[model samples]
Target: MRENLTSVSSLNMAFTDSMKPTDLSADKKGIKRKNWRRRIGFLLKTNSSQPILRLVKNRSYRPSVDDVNQWAQSLDKLLGHKYGKAAFHIFLKSEFCEENIEFWTACEDFKKLTSRKDLVSKANSIHEEFIRSEAAKEINLDFHTKNAIVQSLHAPTPTSFLAAQKKVYSLMENNSYPRFINSDLYKELCAAAKGEGKHIKS
Candidate 1:
């Protein structure tokens, strides 16, 4: 498993090496200049190929008892915790609906853009990747919402995808969240968190 992750990491590096934008720089969050493309691509490849093995391999982001307890409280709480979100993303992948979280995550990052150029470029990218019909990882969006985003791309803003993001969030909250709460992956995480030291919050 470790060997697989290392190979995936290497492949991602090779895939992204020639594609880095010259104008890009690390963000305040210390995210490297590879930005979303590298991550999105790596996630799609890794999740689709090795859902279970990837989870067993990556143990650096161990969850705390409070993290697991908070995750059970709400979808937002779960996403707010880094490890919880990562776990849920894996669960979504295993169910073959990871695009919902992928699109949601892209929008969250999109909202943090301060550069007008970046806002425009990323809005169009998001539209192409997740909004357009037959998009590679398209989410289930209504025509009205999808058209609205298309119309706004020429003058995109930080909130360009706000409506669409909310819709996806609602979809995941209603559908995936319930399943995740009862999933073995989530239960295992809860158990692991408990084993860390303190009793899990009931």
Candidate 2:
């Protein structure tokens, strides 16, 4: 939902107008356009919790051709992956923007992550970091758990499901999850996991 780069579109032109070579503001700042064809590109980072809110450093996050493809694929994966979409729906409520190219920043920082066909590998990195932080009590009970569920969106087996279950249970145990678990999205996932008809909000 949150964008790391500003997409330039004219009122009279197609959205296909590529993102111009301009410094994506990490915050509120002026813009200077550059010749994109000559610019070297780096990558923008995202993860499980606020995956849509990618934070790119000034002049550092220029995206590689492959990374751009992967990031776009990541967006699609979030929409299709059950748990990822579910959790991200909630994130969207808090972060979605009208324009796809608005400058955005994630709520968390990542030290290292892997590259997957889409954003799955990046999401896994965030998930493992959250679990580690929670185990060490480095993160508060709320965020630690929320991110864990987001990671479970890529669940391919029972192990990943159980991992998400552990975090959800911890939330219930601490009595800090009423807002999160009671949401329409969470309940939808809960029902679908139980083989009920309702999985997505109508």
lDDT of every predicted structure (CA atoms): 0.68, 0.31
| Model 1 stretches with alpha carbons more than 4 Å out | 1-61, 196-202
lDDT of 1 by residue, 66-177 (tens): 8788999999998987657876776675455878988999999999999989999999899889999999889999999999999999999888899999999999999999
Write model 2 residue lDDT over 112-197, tens digit each, in one string.
22333334554454355433454321233356556555656474222432444444434333342334344443333334444452
State, as a TM-score between 0 and 1, how close model 2 is to the true structure. 0.21
Q: Each model's TM-score?
A: 0.69, 0.21
Error of 2 at 106 (Å): 4.8
Model 1 poorest 10 in a row by lDDT: 28-37
Q: Output the number of the lDDT-best candidate.
A: 1
User: Model 2 clash pairs?
Assistant: 41-62, 42-62, 42-63, 84-153
